[model samples]
Every structure is written in C-alpha cells, then in structure tokens.
Target: MVTLTSSTAAQRPDFAAIANWIKPNSKILDLGCGDGALLKYLQQKHRIFGFGVEIDDANVLGCLRNGINVIQSDLESGLSGFADNSFDYVILSQTLQAMKHTERIIREMLRVGREGIVSFPNFGHWKNRLQVIQGHMPVSDALPYHWYDTPNIHLCTLGDFENLCKQCDAKILERRVMKQDRPIRFLPNLRGKLAFYRFERQNKSPKSTQD
Candidate 1:
C-alpha cells in the first residue's frame, strides 16, 4: 500500500465537479500528472486505483511522498507498455498544448482506456481573440506563455479541437467550459478559460476494425 506524506496531500484542487462524472472505484491513469495531486484526490475521494505518469523527477518524487503510485515516462514516447483497455478512464489535463503529437497521444489514451477525459486552455477565449486582433500574445491565466519563451508546441481553439475530434473518429460524450472555477457553458468558445471533454473512440465495423 502507498503512503503519502501529509505535506504532499494538501496541494490538490477541488476536482469534485470532474470527479462526479467518473465512475466510482474505476481504475484511472493520469498522464502528465504534476505533483500527483489529482491522482491522490481521486484515490481518497472515489476509491479509485489511480496511476500517475509524469516526466518530471521532482514531481515523481513528490507523488511518492504523497503516497501515490506513479510511472516516470515521457508522454512523447506513448503508452506502449500498458495493454489496451487497461484503465477505465485516462486523463490528460492542461498538458495537450505542450505536446507535439497531440493526436497520437490522444489515440493512445483512447486505446489504453475505455474512456478519456481531456482538458486544455482555450485559445479562443474572448481575451485571447482580442489580443490576437491587437497583434499581441495573450497573457491570461490559461495561457501564460509569451511569443518568445513558451513550452507550448501547439496552440489550439475550442472549434479546432472539436473538428479534430470529428476527424479522428472520436465521440464526445461531454464537454464543460470553465472560467476560474465557475462553469460557462453558454458561450464557451468566447468566454471560457478552459475546455474539458470526455470522449470515446467510435466502434468500427469488423471490416474496418480489421484494416
């Protein structure tokens, strides 16, 4: 059994809104898990058997101290070691923009889990749009990157992500947009700071599946 230190247990967010959507006692994989906060929260609150995959050494150690099980691996390499359908849900939160191969990573997430939850900063927020029109990079809470020094390999909008989901043959089960901690569903594309989506790969016909 894992044993998390008290100091490590105090940094998690109130993910109750998202946690409510997940099935209780489900096995979960959290990719790019920073500090393993979410994983610990899931374990304590939902009785989930959560696994965290993180690349940062400090964060990996922090997860261990927090009594969370974690695997240190680069997201760019893909989750090849895990068998298909190994988890009930695979989560990627706030790390999609940092990946160069977003589609491939998402595909692997779907293959390894029955369902996937993905959340990313929305580049189409009204403030971001306004900044673009004014010929400046947006510096908001969601996107704190400047044009010169930023880790984001790809910057995408809500519409862009939705189109990509359709093109990749993934079905969107749910979508939530948030500003700060409040839900903003009415005009998410224009107002939301973050966009969250729950998705599953569409079942293919036997012939297509074989191909």
Candidate 2:
C-alpha cells in the first residue's frame, strides 16, 4: 500500500507525529509494520512497548534485527487471536488501501486496541485526478506502480475514508494531510499526497455485527 521511503536510520516524519500522539509506556500493535522502523522509533522516543504483525519473512527478520517484538501473521484474518483491548494503540500505516477487507480490518483494529492510527496515499490528489482525466494510471512517489501491477486493490479518497469511519461509529480524534511529510492545512484533498487518521470506537466494547 505504501512504500518505506528511508531506513530506520531516518525516521518517517508522519510516524513521528504518531509518536507524539501516544503517551509514554503505552502498549502498541503495529499492523503491517515494515522492518520495525516505527516500533523502534516509538520505543526510543516514547518509551513504549509493543509488537508488530508482519507477514513478510524478510521484514520479520528485519524486526528481529531491530530488537523489536513482532508476529508473522496475515492481516486479512483479522485480530481475533488477540484479546479485547490488548493494546493501547493499533496502527495500520499506509497499508489500509491495499487490504481487500478494509472495513473488517478497521473494526478488528478497534476491537484489539483502544485506538487506531492509519495513513494512506490520497487517491484524490490533484495529480491523480489529472491522470484520470488523461485516461491513464498516475505514477508518482505515493503511487509507484502500473495500473495492473499496483498492490493497492481498494484505493480511497480522504472523504471516502472519513465516511467509512462514520458508518462504523469510529470517532476520528485526529486527522492530518501531508505533502512531503509536512502537514497541509489548506485544500488538503488537492494538495496533500498522504492522509493520516487517528480514531477510536465510540464505545470500547465491540459492537454487534449484523453480517
């Protein structure tokens, strides 16, 4: 869904913003954590303890090298194995758009952790819109694949994601739009390339699912 720009040597600025959001010593669960960069950063900057769930073997090895606790598991199966509110925060950075069962994953994230943070490439960015007008898939830093080959199966715009959150009764505590890792305050849907959302369930107890 999202690409890792730099190494653990150079931390992601948006994730730094996430670090600021979490309180010190809280527990975390990072979904699709790549190479344990965020977990490493959170420990150093916030003194938090946490685990990551990654399916990639190389990434799991990378997490071990980073001295971070990680679990190798598929996210599509959801967080059923974890106890309710097992973590203080659940993070799904830049991986939300690639998931096939996006709604289920969101609900599961809320169920397993008290709060959830997610980041994704904004599909409604001006460049993507212009490329649609030109009748071709846009290739850029945020979206770096050809139409057929892109790992992103369920792309969504900023508005679309917020609407989904509302439908699920998730309260968005914080939202940010970033361009070049800097926050964009004006017309973010057009200017920003990345969208970040931090949310929690309206009720910590799991809501009954009709389907």
The number of the candidate with the highest lDDT is 2
Please provide, for model 1 over 26-112, each residue's C-alpha lDDT reduced to its tens digit, 9 standing for 90 to 100.
Answer: 999999998887887777777899999999999999889878889999989888878778899999988999998888887887788
Q: Model 1, 193: alpha-carbon shift in Å?
A: 0.8
**lDDT of model number 1:** 0.82
lDDT per residue for candidate 2 within 1-211, as digits (tens), equals 2223435333467776677689999999999998988888788777899899999999999999888899999999877678888899999999998899999999888888899999999999999999999999888889999998989998889999999998778999999898875889899998989999999999879753323
Q: Best candidate per TM-score, number? A: 2
Clashes of each: 2, 0
Residue 132 lDDT in candidate 1: 88
Model-by-model lDDT, in order?
A: 0.82, 0.87
Query: Model 1, poorest ten-residue lDDT window?
Result: 202-211
